[model samples]
Target: MYAHAKEVAEGMLGEANVKIASQNMGGEDFAFYAQKAAGAMFWIGVGNQTTMERVRPLHSPHFVMDESALPIGAAFHASVAIEYLNKNQWCAA
Candidate 1:
């Protein structure tokens, strides 16, 4: 995961036209993809509910989140993106 993240960071950021935002110093989840797509937004996810509820979380013993939550999160991200673009005249740019 770290290697993949580093690869993305290097590939995307080495470009002069691509200005990188908050790297957040690690501890990121797969959620980073959604966040980065939304201008490096950062978020915390609990766990994958679709996965075996009987099984443990990615790291912790007690953490958990529903896969259903992902859609809601995506919606939130879209709304935020719209709001930001509207505020900054991004579309006009």
Candidate 2:
């Protein structure tokens, strides 16, 4: 599943720009979706800004998502969906 998704993602968003997220400790419950059908979840980087000489964690008062990642995330989803649908005729294109 990821093999195809990664191919589509890297194809649309250059191989150099693609990044594999690390440090996934406790797995996400979202994996349950795969049991019903082929499914995958991916991450998009929102960048970190230095705050008080350190990078703050998520949900912090100063934490903010870099808007630049929005377009990339949108494009990634579109590309993955298009590619997957192309391989399988889930519905009319």
Candidate 3:
């Protein structure tokens, strides 16, 4: 992710919640999109830690998500967008 984007995300989501993942060899389509535009892709914590035993890895048949985090994820997206736009003066356009 771009440095500015990461900074924006960290500003919106507390630094403790925003983690900088180590570089990996994983293939993601977002890499192509990012080549042409400034963008970022983030993962939200959807697993309920209290029910760790019930939680399953993504794509697993028993995979389950804590629905309560949905609103927080939504807010994060909106906050990032609004803050990025405001900083870039895009909202005034």
For model 2, the superposed segments whose C-alpha errors exceed 4 Å read 48-55, 90-93
The window of 10 residues in a row where model 1 has the poorest summed lDDT is 1-10
Best TM-score among the predictions, by candidate number: 3
The stretch of ten residues in a row with the least summed lDDT in candidate 3 is 84-93
Regions more than 4 Å wrong, model 3:
90-93
- TM for candidate 3 is 0.77
Residue 73 local lDDT, model 1 = 55
For model 1, name the residue pairs that clash: 47-65
> Rank order by lDDT, top first?
3, 2, 1
lDDT of 2: 0.77
Q: Tally clashing residue pairs in candidate 1.
A: 1
Could you estimate the TM-score for every candidate?
A: 0.37, 0.75, 0.77
- Across 36-84, the per-residue lDDT of candidate 1 in tens digits comes to 6634433434355457565454566765556765775575456555655
Best by lDDT: 3
Residue 48 lDDT, candidate 1, scale 0-100 = 55
Candidate 1 Cα deviation (angstroms), residue 35: 15
